[model samples]
Target chain A: MTSSHLVYLIALPLFSSAFLILMGRKADKWGHIFATLISAAVFGVGVSEFMAMHSRAGDMRAVTQHLFSWISVGTFQVDASLLLDQLSICFVLLISGVGTLIHIYSIAYMSHDKDRRRFFAYLNFFIAAMLLLVLGDSYLNLYVGWEGVGLASYLLIGFWNQKPTYATAAKKAFVANRVGDVGLSLAIMIAFAQFGSVTFDGVKAGVHGASPAALTALGAMLLLAAAGKSAQFPLQSWLGDAMAGPTPVSALIHAATMVTAGVYLITRSNFIFDGSSTARLLVVIVGGITLLFGALIGTAKDDIKKALAASTMSQIGYMILASGLGPVGYAIAIMHLLTHGFFKAGMFLGAGSVMHGMDDEVNMRRYGAIGKVMPITFATFGLGYLAIIGVPPFAGFYSKDKIIEIAFNAGGTKGIILGGATLLGAAITAFYMTRLMVMTFAGSKRWDDKAHPHESPVLMWLPMVVLAIGSVATGFLFNSGNSLVNWLAPVLNPNNVESGSELMKPIVVSSLALLAVILGVALAVTKYRTVPVEAPEDVSIFTKVARRDLLQDAFNETVLMRPGQILTAGLVKTDYFAIDGLVRLIGAVVSGTSTFLRRIQNGYVRSYALIMVIGALALIATIWVVTL
Target chain B: MDISNYLYLSAILFTIGAIGVVVRRNAIVVFMCVELMLNAANLAFVTFSRINGNLDGQVASFFTMVVAACEVVVGLAIIVTMYRSRRSASVDDASLLKR
Candidate 1:
């Protein structure tokens, strides 16, 4: 709660990264030690913060560490203060907790990488940036961390720069995010213009006094910024492209920490969003579309990591849904975030294990009947699938199921849409997951004889095994109606955990969702399992309509891509002509001057004297006119 | 005329020197042109000091003159070096790039 405690979270990693970089070429050996220690300690501090928050859940603890006055002008002041509250704690937990797992996993994942030291250093750097992002009390400070996370993501995504595709993917993620970041910067300008303040506390107060139209516009614009960062709907295409990065990074920035920043921003300004139903509805609608889209696309992908990425997109949809539910749903959304962090990290690591053994072959078709060879990996994979599918008694089931109930309780068209959309996504989730599980783990052997797929090293499996436990236990935390909700009763205060199950009639909802999950498993198993255990790499219908993401990529290529290329060419052409035109004009003037001046070199002394006389006469005439 | 008129006249002279530096092909002329712009700015600084009844402007001008003198000496030294090395002061012909 003191300044030192707040300072430690940031300074520990910041200094260690500096120390690691200073070690130069010997960075790998020393860098690993520094990164692992800092992340674990930060996670410890986060746990303490959560405990502290839990103790005082009813009151928002304004833990401020005022480093100095950041800005001071004519009636404009903002402190370089770090804030600790429910919001900061939630982010701190995500950054440090998921961060710790990624750090450990990297020790194995990047052990053979030549730039292992640099990898650890970048990981630490991202954590520090993410910390600053969450802990900053003011908009300007948050933006510093916001843009910093963007820089870290860009660097880490293309860690293997030898591949041009990796570099392009990194650039795509960076540039696309910049488009949304502009809205954030503009929104900050608007906030400053209308309210003359930028602190979280200040802006919240200002919103109360602001016009409804202004509030709605500001809220929607801010959510747009969040949507890009969090991979919601229109801005989500870059996320699929982000598979070019290391899998551990997908677990960290893409899944756990960085993408959730959008929700953090919106939820922090819960007061502002509550004022505008339109803004809230837009949130629900966008979230619903992304959830359904991501899961469907996820179902159609063969690259193991890309499938997880699409699933990441879908999971973030649930977070957006929770955020739109306001504060009551806020706790559930964050809990969902926490549980998703564990399971998603584990699933990615498990996929990494399978890839490691298969010599980087991630296509599930090459991996059939892997359950016998790698039992541990298979078990963790099964737990992850269950957690993700929201099977009863798992963390994903509780958190995801709660979101569906929240949607139904909100009532009206949106309620029905969210509730229905989430259920439908749940079915596809089960189907694709069942299809994937059977193809990868349940069916007969498929790999070549020389390729011996085995369990990952214990270093990797430890994290997966632990997270599998978390995914199973976490859902039950919320099972007794208000159990999970009551845990955070301190934050939302006196309001009893809205028995959402009661309101939405959880019995019917659960049975229906349960039935959907069952149906998905049944159909996928019936079609693929008994057919000689030979899941076709390309079923004609699956090939035409499903696998290439229903021709989204193809459609983008012909419909969006060709036109985009032409437009880019046209812009370049216009730019080229305009620039070349100016260059030629300047060149012509210079050459013309050179030509005109050549007469001076014609060896004509008498003519030169005659020109001097004419110049003198002209000057005298001008002077005489002025004198007159 | 007010002291500002002298400074204003110096400015016009400086501009003429600047154009000579640009228009001429001799290194010495360009070196002399830079001195002219510095002196013009210094003269304006002093004029404004008197107009405002302050001494800070004059003090700055004095320092500017000292720096400008040091710069001129350095500039000539470099030109001398170039001449010794290349045996030419015609700035256009001193294009070692072509060689």
Candidate 2:
């Protein structure tokens, strides 16, 4: 296949989404199946393209397809083009591959929903947008895809918008994403100003000529955009609330596509980040903070999907943190991303399966020992759990341990601090994930008599089983010979060489990471081995704060929303009084003067004659005066 | 006679007619005063033509005499209708347009 087929990778899902939506309720019975088939078809296309690329050598692996001239001006030009390269191929497979599985799962999960067709349409739209995001060759072209995914995410999150809170959650996510989008816009503008072009190739070639200050600014702005999309730190309050969406949506956003966009953006812009150590350090710090932030929140969440969402945030944090570690960390971050996509998506689908059996009850406190009833969900979800905790031979072990190794090998005090943080994040991740497992599957049954936990249909568990297999195998396979790293070197680090000495050996790092996981697991098992049906009312201040999402919303309201509200109110008052008052004053003066002048029109003939005679006398007097 | 003296007599007659038209309330009186003013203007035109030894002013006086004749016909008719409608000849009775 030629590179021109790249367009179909995006267009197929996009047009199918549009078609299903336009067909409306008439296609309800088969709309979901049609959507699934389209997703699978897109995946097939991506696989064929991958096979074609694999047959080629180093320089030829990356291919570009130019569709048309997008924008042109004096010395400024852009093309609507697509790039199917090593880095994007990984994302393509993950998005469409995991996306297809989620689609299959949704067929059964959403079968009872009357608007299931609309849900599939949104899912297809999300897949198309995500594909565009990775395949776009330039920052400007990528923006279209960025916004596309944001819209899809908003629509899917609010799919059950009859509930007011669900609608509000969607709005929150959209607003937060807008904040990040501003960063992307600014970064693109900076790139254009500095390099005179916005294409990835152009920017990479020009980066050597650009000043460090400009590069740092560009890098910082890109990171800001990543932070928004990936739910890192201050911009991340929406991820937990976003769980108000359906379970498949959570899996798609957290595991497969939407949140991983941040990692893709940073890695794609590796040239800029490499030039700016300040920006790189900032990315690492944000990643470090958010990993802990999400892990802490995960430990306190009662809702099962929300807990998984928190873990997704923390896992992305590891990827972001790893990407920030410079050349050595980029491939490792993507490896973790791919693995996280598998395990996290599988776990979320498993959660959905559990929900399907338990009347959509989301509280883990209310869910205990349902694993006995739903064996496939339990087994698949357990495999994912093991993978997430970085247990040996699992996907997370290879990827996450590599990130931990890289962090420690960064050298000096920086390495020590970053290494410590990753280690701590690993421990907390283990604790929260173990707590989730024990509460949902290990403890005594906490549900009421009305609840009957049963296995989901074959359609639902099949996808989970496949992803669970991925979680158990993908990390080892990708790490066996550093194949993923070597494959991505042309894009991430063309002059690749091992430059640094290790502060901690890979074996040491693995041991420490495993120890941390064991410690966290032991604590969680001992503490939550017997969870009460009802959560205790009196908790420590830390638990209380964590339970409330660490006051992120409160901080935003006080620091951002309140000031914005005040400013808007002041502007409104000024417009009403100052601007409008001036117009009102002008009108009043004209009307008042007209009223005063109107009194002279008395209807008496004698008075009119007297005035006319006086006017004639005055005219004669004026003539005499002028002559004299 | 000198033409200046004729002009002064015409101006005095015109002023008197104007005062009569403004002060008198009777519609018939006002009509007669307007005719007087028009004739005074025609007298001034004849005097000016004699002084200048030109036919232009004489032709103008003839034109004024024609217009005055037409005015008298229309003005007298309007005054008759006003008297018939209001049962009074006062020009003040037709002041409805003041406001």
Which portions of model 2 show Cα errors greater than 4 Å? A497-499, A596-628, B1-99
DockQ of each: 0.02, 0.46
Error of 1 at A66 (Å): 1.7
lDDT of 1 by residue, A202-308 (tens): 88778778888887787788888888888887678778878788878887888778988887877766767777878887787778888888888877776788888
After superposition, the stretches of candidate 1 with alpha carbons farther than 4 Å from their true spots are A1-3, A53-57, A60-62, A478-484, A487-504, A530-546, A550-572, A575-583, A586-590, A593-597, A608-628, B1-99
Instruction: Supply fnat for every model shown.
Output: 0.00, 0.52
- Docking quality class, candidate 2: acceptable
Q: Native-vs-model 2 lDDT? A: 0.93
Candidate 2, clashing residue pairs?
Answer: none
Candidate 2 structure quality by residue, lDDT tens digits, A458-549: 99999999999999999988988889999999999887957379886788899999999999999999999788877887999999999898
TM-score chain B for all models: 0.85, 0.93
* Residues B1-99, model 1: lDDT tens digits: 667687778779766665656566668876787687788878878888898899999999999989998998998998898888888776766645433
Candidate 1 TM-score restricted to chain A:
0.90
